[model samples]
Target: MTAGNPTPDTTAEPAPGPESHPEIPWERLSARMVWINLVRLVISVVPGVLATAVLDTPTGPAWPLLVASAVGVSATALACLRFLSTRYRVTGERVERTTGLLVRKYRYVPRDRVRSVDSSARLRHRLAGVRVVHIGSGEARSSFKLDALTAATAEELRRELMPDAAGEPEEEAGRETLGPQPGPHEEVIARFRKPWVLYQMFSVWAVLVVTGPAFGLHWLLQPFGVDLLELVGELVDYERRGFWWSLALCLAVAYPLGFIGLALTFVMSHWDFTLVRTTAKGHPVLLTRRGLLSTRTVHRDETRVRGITFREPLLWRWLGLTRTSVITTGLRQGPDEDSAAGVLPRVRMWEAREVAARVLTGEPSPLEAPLRRHPRGALTRRLVWAACGPAVVTGVLFWLGRTDVLPDRAWLVGVGAWPVTLFAAVFSYLALGHALSGSYLVVRRGAVNRSTVALQHRAVIGWTLRQSIPQRLGRRVTVRIPTPAGERHYVLPDASTRQALAFIKGSTPQLAAQFIGEAESGGRRAAPPP
Candidate 1:
């Protein structure tokens, strides 16, 4: 509250305003935000103080105090300027942020472009009764952020930005903008089960999180003058006991520790995860809320979602688990923000497909059709590339053996690498496949971390087809489907002219039928050149 004005009673019901008001009065950020900023600065300074204590700095103890005073004065001045200049206003159509002293910065976002509103509070912010607000614009990056605002003010701002379409049929003049409303009529689509989270724990991220740190720790210890490899070598004598015994001991110690870290990561990140769909202002919106320390709430406009992907790993496939994620124009594509994409983290295959129908139109199971496999030539190409590594390794080993640097048996390792690489290459080639199920075009690929992306035909706006000289020889063409969410491609390695025509017509039958018919009437000329 400003010193001169009375604080608005936040608990009291807000008076309704005109549905098509030009703008709300510009609201200044709380003056208390200055204190919050100071507190945050102090918290960040603690790490520097601790580092100085550990490392011998040229500056003495008095230098720390001087530095602290300088920082405090700088922060205080900046906070004063920020509190005075920064102001935000919400209108019927847009949210505006006006700040900066000299040049003046004005950021504006139309309400329709706003995709999601995320709120988070650090310990200091929580104590200060404020939270940082993030407004996502469905872009690759977010530009609007409200650094510190009172919890009530933030909620009020969010509500104003999201007008009640249910209350007012239209945003005409002389109509109320907001009204006392009950929660939206929402049904439980799916809830998180412990078994599902357990399955999610064994994901690709878990493998990296568990083992990456172990290797990193070994490297990190080197800077401290501790030789990890030398210590382990001294502890386990290969001469007295077999090398296999020492290797087994290392695995026994490392794996359990990895599992512990994996479990803890899963619990911390996915605590109280829930997916709920409810109608807001008569429009269906999907809400996903989760996280322990940093809780996140994403309100997705259901209309913006383009499609979904059912990701199945090799081990998870055998266990009958499939991870479901949404492809939305409103959310960024990455693991961290991808949770906004995740409809179901890890669910029974049947359960996932069942829920997918509600989330999307057309066939519930998008992988219904028999996928058209790539040509054998594609497999041969993959094998050639896969053999390159083994070939290089074999050459190096032979050179070493000739120089007496390594035993002759070292070259034999390349022979073992060959079969493994061949198997992997074949597996990857076999996995290259695509299907057309109802209104969805599905593409399944990958060897270890298999992903099956099902995109809605209605969501597709354009198609691009490309064929290389080698791919052309094999009658293979890559078709890229572009949507607002992202671009997804299918490799039709062995497809005949008819199959390729059918695939194109499937996406836009009305648009492509004329061209396809003309080609068909042209006889052999329609067929791709040999």
Candidate 2:
């Protein structure tokens, strides 16, 4: 085949790409991984190691510093070795990984077993233009990772492994989408807003920082002979002011600085986020990619998504903000698990519901279904449980006051908390409900930070009924629906014995009929007789 005289059409070879020639070679991780690991060690591990050295200086010329240096060097060497030993490739038949410098372990995953593909890039990896590709399977422990691949290479493997993740759409929830929907090749499902990060200003972390910090930066560095207040005074060239005014000014300055730090964290994790709908092997996938410094992309098989969870904390709920996440199987949740499952950041409640409808493919959000309130016995159960704590505290406080060690009014502290506890119990009772919505089973629970879950019927793998002594006494039972997704189970607590059985029967007709008997008039029925 000379230049201009092309090879015969049939004899022409297909493009030498991943899908075209997966037999390419046994590829090693990026060489830049060495530098990335070194940087990370310096930023994360080295500082703490050096701090430990400062606190305990092991006598002769700081042996601790030498030890820290040795540890950092050893760790960096191990990382480099790891980079050399790790090799992975994608093939038409299966994906394979070979590791272990000495033992040489070989692992293979059949193409069909590939359940999810996630790629992540932290600040160091981003600087090196590499990403860590995490390949997951239905079996939780079967997941493996290939770190330090060039971004292009990681993207290629992801496309090759998740074939449907290319340019196609699956079922087009577009028609049912009440929110942003995919159009043509532009599959933008959800786009993150910068202002959404502001919601974190009201987060528990921010509140704690403002009201009662567990520890302060000054506290941490003060041991190292650094006084933050003195440094601030010297920098500003201000003489010593009144103690209370200086303290108040320090607190005022620290509060905003703490909030700024929180805001930075939010931005680092969720800036420029997007959720898109795409296809993988003829099935639709909810693809979410986000992050500022440490970026991540998660390809969630829509088929494996059991449900959507709209979590509304007390503060967020009052502000009408909801955070959205999915109950998807084989997600391989880690320390940053919330971010892995989250489809939308804290957003308006209506917007969150709209996003839920878009992902779940329903007209009215499954969350909109009218939930049947739990029986009054459930309320009684809550009251009894809520009262136990307050009663015990009040009795202890009364005894303490009676002993003359504590003031008579000291017991009032415990008594005052009772009303708040009772109010919470009532709210918990009111929030308890379950309903069937289309192909989804909707359940709402919790007094604070209420979670409304809309679980898909087919996703439920098993049913469990537990009637504890207390539940039996109250004529109530707890029904647990187990699924491979999310927390592995969803619970409906304190339903009437009869209604629990009835709910199970309605949700899974064939399976329930084989076990649960008809409801009795007293809302109690005998268990299956041996």
Candidate 3:
């Protein structure tokens, strides 16, 4: 009660705003963030510090080492202390952060705008016993992060930010979180399996997954005089020998080693994978936690989840394993956007479907629904690219070899690849499909990585029509749907103009409403997708 104000009316409703939630206050980042930053500083300074200490200067070896050490410590301590200036809070209406000492920067995201609550902890941060939290709203610049929070606090914040996850009240059920796994109250939808490891081990294309990172590391170390890729190239050089022999030798060495590396990585990364269903606020949320050394936790509000993608790579699809990822507005779409969005690693198709249904809160998964097959012209278009395209390349190489422009082996190589290309084209044609499944718009395509995505009808913002010279000649058009989630747009390639327009109209009426009547009245009305 204020001194002049007659004791504030006891029953008066709270004035509102910040006063409405007295429990929440501006919170500071964990002090251990200083340790995490210091570790990074030491790692950066050690090499230079050692080189300086090795030089015999007027300041002596010991003095250089000691002085460099002192400077590093001072700089790190001051820089990391910026955590002291940072403060954030979660109010009923917003998630706010305040930073900067002199100028004072304050920013807040409305509670409704928060899309995902993701938390991760690297090895050093784990050693310091802290996790970093990110609250993303699809947009890159608007994302807010909290670094170095206690594991428990990070989990609490994750729950607070994602209010739509459905679950029973913890107080009523008397549940407590244990270790890295979900508490007994949380329902786990999927987990790691040994067969997944073996499936990857037997994969003929595993070399790409294993060597991609090795090549990146080798590139980074090139300035340091490390040339691992060059060494590999020298070993596999085919200039002095038959290309076939060199190819065989390279395959022999890469296959077993690639298998072991990929399997080990698979085991280490997904040793304790778990996809759990939990509740926040009144809505349901999907929470996925995995990894052995560096743990990652992705908390996505069920409402923001626009769809699911079932991706089947060539070899994995043959091996009966499929990779599953969710399409959510909370996740930013970019080159590697789906990497962190994967809800399940490669697993049996049925297991993937079951988990999809569980997360989607439906008994019969949408993937089970029949899809409208593409017209024969689409298949003809694929055959031209798959068969004639390679045949044309082979003919060009043959002509070039006769003209002394390229080696005879180039044409021979094209001959050898023609059959495989044709086979792939046929498989891709078979996979081409699209349909409107109740509340979802389904589009499936791709040969190397056959991906079938089920997007919500309401998530579609608009439609785009594209046609190439060949497509125009064949009277076909490619339709792309623009959405805020996944890849800004999803594509339906080489469908008849009439059918594509019909699909557009079926998914979202207004976009195609203007085009449909004219298209149908102009020609024999296309049969509605069965």
- Model 3, 167-247: lDDT tens per residue? 522111111121444334678788877787876577767677657877666644443455777777688886776778887
- Candidate 3 stretches with Cα past 4 Å from truth are 1-33, 37-112, 144-185, 202-254, 332-340, 386-405, 408-417, 468-473, 505-515, 523-530
**Cα lDDT for residue 425, candidate 3:** 81
lDDT: worst 10-residue window of model 1? 171-180
Best lDDT goes to which candidate? Answer: 3
Ranking by TM-score: 2, 1, 3
Name the lDDT of candidate 2.
Answer: 0.69
Clashing pairs in 1: none
How many backbone collisions does model 1 have? 0
Per-model TM values vs. the true structure? 0.70, 0.72, 0.68
Model 2, 477-523: lDDT tens digits are 88888776777778898898777766776777766644565234243
Cα lDDT listed for each candidate: 0.65, 0.69, 0.71
Deviation in Å, model 3, residue 15 alpha carbon? 30
